[model samples]
Target chain A: MSLVVIGTVAFDAIETPFGKTDKIVGGAATYASLAASYFYDKVKIVAVVGDDFHKEDIADFKNHGIGVEGLQIKEGEKSFFWAGKYHNDMNSRDTLITELNVLADFDPIIPDSYQDCEYLMLGNLTPQVQRTTIERLKNRPKLIVMDTMNFWMDIAMDDLKQTIKLVDVLTINDSEARQLSGEYSLVKAANKILQMGPKYLIIKKGEHGALLFHEDLVFSAPALPLAEVFDPTGAGDTFAGGFIGYMAKVGTVNFNNMKNAIIFGSALASFCVEKFGTEKIRNLSSEEVSARVQQFVGLSSFVIGQ
Target chain B: MSLVVIGTVAFDAIETPFGKTDKIVGGAATYASLAASYFYDKVKIVAVVGDDFHKEDIADFKNHGIGVEGLQIKEGEKSFFWAGKYHNDMNSRDTLITELNVLADFDPIIPDSYQDCEYLMLGNLTPQVQRTTIERLKNRPKLIVMDTMNFWMDIAMDDLKQTIKLVDVLTINDSEARQLSGEYSLVKAANKILQMGPKYLIIKKGEHGALLFHEDLVFSAPALPLAEVFDPTGAGDTFAGGFIGYMAKVGTVNFNNMKNAIIFGSALASFCVEKFGTEKIRNLSSEEVSARVQQFVGLSSFVIGQ
Candidate 1:
């Protein structure tokens, strides 16, 4: 019933066609923990922030039932920051700035209370941070899910490969899946990556939908077609959060259980795109989430002639 | 139920990386009727062929439960012929040869025997011919489905618009849907085109899968992932045949019934690509078709908990 999530908890500036936001509270761990918080109350979060990291932000997490005790704030440094501008297509964008501040040199400290958490989510971070966190765990959690960006694939593929072998499931976007497996056909890509280790491979196709591959079985869950997709910043992490969070709540890792989890993930992602990073998913009502999930369930269900 | 299908019935020379076929029997109607024959025996086919059209080739349709009484054999004329080469990516092809021959000015003549048909399938043809056939039907069929290519959208858009208003459903591929509606998003294109006429829209995604849109309901059926795709020439027509054919077999036009029909169509199209120019679909045993349908049924069926 407990979860520990770790990645970057920082700031971002995003410009999309709908509008633009300057220096919003955005980061991997921020979105992940918020999404997971909806399902679990014993959610311990770990991240390195600088003096600029708001104390009121920690208070907000505490109010949302997220344990912010594990967050380590360095007094004199600035937090990691990123800015990007989206194109008309909204699928591709250009990064305008990346300032690695406190994140440039950091060490993760897993708290004693977090050791007993049954679920562990590794948000996109350095391979060493991910590997070191696993090493810090006093006992193995029930399930470990990891996410990584293409940046690490280019610089630390070997380390990434080694870390991938340790997780129960690996979640990556379509481009990263193709880049990592060197196969354009996602079916082939999933099969190739399966040989590299993880038992489950979730290839996130963004707007297209996600493909969940386990052995010879593959399930595609379509993304909800919202009229507008404002900011896509944390949609992926939000998806990962809902996927693992629902699985942890149900406490079953069977294929059928994961099918519903995938739907839940897609529903959570649909909300993420309704507004800029974390705004929609953060305040999402249980009723709203349930309705959207039911819509997805309804779209694909029908009776057949006997 | 009796069905009448009219379109190209000619010769094609196609080459793919896997193999090549020289002057093989192909055409939109040729594949369409053959696929429909599996579900209904009394199927009438109409198409124009020339003196070069092989007698034995015409016999192939007759042997497959297709009544060729509506076929027009033009004396001293050449059979319509086309040649194309597929690239590694199956999404596109380059036409090497196209001799319009009998198809240059096709005017469909519905035989008295074909007048009793309850289902009408208008395969990809000139908009004028499609419109003429609709007018030629002595009695309106219970269900009419039409398929058209992008070429008609460019040259005979007005005729195509008129043709669209007369059919119950319209089938087109992804690119064709975009061109016909002048919309980039498939959902937007489908919405725009649906306003044009047909109550239902099936946008075939080739190897990826196909989408079925009716009113506000949409269902996606994935294509079977084959290791190799030999040829994709008549797959779309084969899909339409299986689609309308199953609807004929199911005896209803409800969304639930058409949902399964899409799966059957997808399964039939999957078999069509395993060999060149309808070779695989023609040789498929009932057991093989049932087995492939079962795969699609398995791939999409998953129950979720509340």
Candidate 2:
């Protein structure tokens, strides 16, 4: 079973307290594909980037065993670029610039070989585009997980809800969850959002950790406390990647499996923040990934009865 | 073994979005002692309240199997009264009034019978008072856990630091941890705070949960998410009470034991927020406490591959 990933593949300039990064490889699809590649071998990417994007970058996807047949290159255009500065606390950021070039009129084309995808990950994108991609699929994937942000809820809420209705799982941050449901209590927010469509909801709280809600069951995963969070640009995307990747690898969608997937996703995201814009995510070895997962096991694992 | 609790025992008026309460029995030591009573049988309270405090309030302590020998009742004076209003979020509050009458000239006199205490809980109070209680104990307790606030750190840094040095575990909120260590990252903040002499540190994140940090090892316990947080008053003190109470019951002071204590503490704190002041905590049964703790285990429990 293959895993399909769809979102932006673009350039990013990030400024954090630790340091600043020049325009480097970033985007929802880029981080998602890279993180998923670590767990699942048959990873397919459907994203649009400008001709300015170098060939080496495409080769990097191939090196990670990701299919590039669906990656489209628009001629005579620049890749989507985002510039943002993170506050001292690393919880909030101020967007400096968002230049959507090729992504403005982008279209996703799924390669015929990618038709067998069993797990679909819709990264943060225009809700309309997400719905279009879902409609384009020949057969609905066994599991469809979508990640969205407050931006869509603020502007294209109708489309966002429509897209949400088509997915099995939805992931968003804490404040976004509050905004979407108009409930300050996350438990109440999760309950309200679950009625809107997705069978599962994951509320990402950055350093505070992530919570997964399904029906009457809830699972909370803790974020590993690090001495520094170099950059948080692609951490959420990376988390989604690891989550879908693990599910695709295990070929299961049960609650127990999802719990483990959350841990795996959290472990991957922890590595993503140790450096800027996929730099840390790109070079991870199997041993490193295993060790990081162990850290999570240590961080949250406890036996009740002694 | 008996657990000795030292802190304010006073009256409080609380206002929350749910409702408001008149002069109810509420204080750090009051909450601490009551929470501890659920775990340990011999819980001794060393605090001073004025004559204005109700006779039935003292009876309530004895009813919970708590020792009132160390409790001093000052004649013809009002008890320390604090009025606070909880915001809509229920995570933060604003102090509306503070009337430190009986607590001002309060001298904590540890009764001779209380000298057999094995666990010591120092709830939020003046650093000098906490230090004095520690010094007054004829024999050092097996374990000392101290809780302090940012207020003390702001006005009496020297005394806070000195008192912190004498404790085995120090519990403070996330922002207070940052303020005390001058570091924004909790991991860095925990490292710096550990240097101040507490062998273990717990950075309580209110609704998010709590983190236990000790030399290179960390364990995170999530707070049980509720549909409503009616009131947050005395939750922290209740947490400390449960933690030390569990430790005293188990008669152990290792990382594993501390992990269980943190979970037990989190369970009790969850109930504290469900109702205003100590109403919920005051009427808990052992079965109810165990069931609450089971919820915490379910919320965070996950099994990875062996």
Candidate 3:
């Protein structure tokens, strides 16, 4: 049972209040796969990069025991590059550039070895692309979690809703949930989104926290309030990675296990924002992860009767 | 051990998107004492109102098992009246009228029968009055929880700071904590505010939740995502009352008890926002309160490695 991640693996230039970074290795798959590597082995990546992508970074994937057989390398083309500036609050950002050179006409290639996929994570991408990958899978994964954004809801909502119907879980930020459901109240929004297709809906509220709603039950996970958020570029992807990674490790798709997954996901996302890009999530030890999980337990646990 | 609440007991005209009310029985002391009375049997309210205050409204406090001996009733003066309109988001409001009638020359009088104060809640009043109540107590209470707003921080900084030093716990909203500490980050803001005097700090973030910070530990409580927020006027005061009231009932002030207190506080605040002014909190059953508390448990509780 292996986990498969599909998204862009490209370059990004990020500017936060603390500082700025030049063109650095960043993408939905890079952050997601890196976070997943800490929990599960034999993780496969199905993404497209260009010649501009560094060989050392490719080696870094091997270093983390991530399978790259499906990581298609386009010949003699620029990699997808994005540039954004985070405001002082770090909650909002202004997109400065979007150079989708290699990704514009990309095709997702599922490797023969990736047929053993038991868990699938469709990161932020074009709805048609995500749908294509889902259709390409020979055997449907045990659990499929898809993360999308308001951008798709704005542009390709029909296709997005079509893709959303194929997944078991849908994860999006709070406002995106509002935009998708056209309801300001998150509970109401979750109800409407759940009706669209997904059995479970996770509403990520950035710094506020994340909420998981499965039918009538709801669970809230708090974002660890940091002294300073160095960068928030990959935090959401990291959260999604940790979630599906934990699920793959536990080998269950039940609500109880999903609760723990959220804790682990929130823990990983907390670490992701402490540094620029994927710097903080790249080198987490098992001991550090366990300790961070314990911090979440400490941060949230309370006994009422005693 | 008794719980003492001190703030205003007057009339308010509130306008919200859901609805509006004219000259309803509302005030910090009114809401706080009512919420506290549900937890602690001996709840005393020390507030001033005028003859215009309904005789039936004063009797309503007695019906809630609240002691009103210290509620000074002035002759011929109008009760304090405030009029406010909530914005679309319900997170902000515009104060249309503030008539400080009976409260203008208010002198908090501690009733001779209420000397056994073990838990004192200074509920969003003039810092001078809060400090005077502290000085008038023959024996210092075991726990003193003070609730203040940005309004006081703006008009009475020195008095606010001086009174802040005298409390065991300080409850303020998120922005108020930032305003008091001159820090944008809540973790940094909490650290600076903790240095100012209070041993424990509760930063209430309406709609998001509340955060409990004591020394090096932090716990977050999520607000129940309601379909609609009818009014948000006295929710903060009601939260503080439930917190201190639970602390008094449990007869402890430790972190574990404080965690449950926050849950209870958040639950009461949740009810407060469901109706205009103090309507929802006027009559709540123990079963309803328990069920609400259990909803908080379900909303926030998660188990790992069961």
Candidate 4:
């Protein structure tokens, strides 16, 4: 069994208060698969890139034991490239450029070997494509987690709703959850969205941390507070990747497992933000990850005598 | 030993998206003392009210086994009255009126009976007044937790710093922390603020939750996600009250105890926002508080196999 992550594997130019990067390696699938590889060995990626994508970049995934059989590289077309500048706060950013080169009419092709996928992570993409990927799979994965943003909801509400109904878990930021449910209260927002489709909802609050809601149960994960957030790019995707990757490793689907998964995911995402793009997350040691997870444990653990 | 809370004991007219209230019995000392009463029995108040404050309002404290000896009534004068309206999100508010009648020349009178104070909670008040309260104590309290706001940092920064130096723990919202430290990063802000004097600092993030920072240790407390927030006024004071109250009960001052105190405080603050002013917190049973605390424990608890 394997964990299949499907999203864009392209280039990004990012600028933050600390510094700026020039077209570094970045993408939803790249970060997600790299994060997942830390926890689970059977991690595979299905993404569309272009000739501009270097072989060394693809080799990084192989070095981490991440499968690249489904990573499509177009012969002549350039890859999708995005450039954005983050304000001093690092919470808000302005998109300077978005060149959807090879991603415009790209089709996700799941290789035959990926048929044994037990966990599927659908990163931000067109709702139709997300749904199509699910339908095309020979057998449905044991768990499906989908992450989307406000952009899709703004233009494709109908399609978004349809795709949302197919996932086992849905993850979105606090603002997107508010925007999607039209409720100012996150608890109310979670309740409304739970009825729309997914059995569980994970509302990512960035620096504030993340919340996991399943049925009548809710789990709050604390974010590791850092003196400085170097770059927040791909933190969300990395979080989702780590979450499902942990789940696949455990081979169980329950509220308890999901809670631990969130902490593990938060630990990974914490590392993702310490440097530009995937620089911090690409070369993590197991000891470093475990130590960071322990930091989270210490960050929120408290005992009260009854 | 007693927990003496010093601040305004006046009237407030609050308006939220849910509804609005007339001039109700709302004040910093009132909320803090009432919340502290649940955890510690020897809770007292030191504040100046006016003739407009009804006998029943004073009875409310007595009913909770709180000492009112230090509560001085200024005859023929109106109690400090504040009117504010919360925005739709309930995070921001606009102050419509601030009538500091009796509170303008407020003198916190520490009663002889309250001389045994061991845990002092200086609710939101003038920096000079908070310092005065500390000075008036014959012996230094084992734990001093001061709650301040951006207003003091704006106009009386020098006085604020002097007062902050006297407290063991300082609690302020995120924005106030940023404004006082001139640092956008909370971790950086906490470090700067801690250097000023306080051994510990808490940056409250309303719906996001609260963080407790000490030396190099940090504890993140999860805020109960509510379906509706009837009113947010006095929630912070209530939190401070619960925190110091728990400390007094435990008779300990350590990071572990502080973490639990924050959770207990958060549970009380959660009840505070469920209704306007102190309606919900004023009458909470011990069983109810315990159940709420347990909910908090369950909300953030997770175990990972080593």
Query: In order, what DockQ does each candidate have?
Result: 0.44, 0.90, 0.81, 0.94
Which regions of candidate 3 fall more than 4 Å away from where they truly are? none
lDDT of each: 0.85, 0.93, 0.92, 0.94
Task: List residue ranges in candidate 4 displaced over 4 A.
Answer: none
lDDT of 2 at A71: 94
Q: Model 1 compared with the native: what TM-score?
A: 0.95
- Candidate 2's C-alpha runs over 4 A off are none
Say which prediction, candidate 1 or candidate 2, comes out ahead on TM-score. 2
TM-score of chain A of each: 0.97, 0.98, 0.99, 0.99
Top-scoring candidate (lDDT): 4
What TM-score fits each model? 0.95, 0.99, 0.98, 0.99
A1-306 in candidate 1: lDDT tens per residue? Answer: 488998899989999988899787888989888888777677889898999977777787887899877788998899999999998767889999999899998788888878787888999999899989999998888889999989999999999999998998899998899899998667888899999988999988776677788999987676665445778889889888888888889898877877788888888888888898778877878889889888777666655454
**Model 4, position A77: C-alpha lDDT score:** 94
Model 4 per-residue lDDT tens digits across residues B1-306: 899999889899999888899999999999999999999999999999989899998998999999999999989999999999999989899999999999899888788898899999999999999999999999999999999999898899999999998899999999999999999999999999999999999999999899999999999999998998889999999999999999999998999999999999999999999899989988898999999999999999999889
Interface RMSD of candidate number 2: 0.8
Model 2 residue B146 CA deviation (Å) reads 0.5
Model 2 residue A147 lDDT score: 97
Q: Tens-digit lDDT track for model 2 on B1-306?
A: 589999999899999989999999999999999999888999999999889999999999999999999999889988999999988877778999999998898888989999898899999999999999999998898899999999998999999999999999999999999999999999999999999999999999988899999998999888788888888899999999999999988998999999999999989998998888889999998889999888998999888884
lDDT of 4 by residue, A85-122 (tens): 99999999999999999999979998999999989999
For every candidate, C-alpha RMSD to the true structure in Å: 2.0, 0.9, 1.2, 0.8
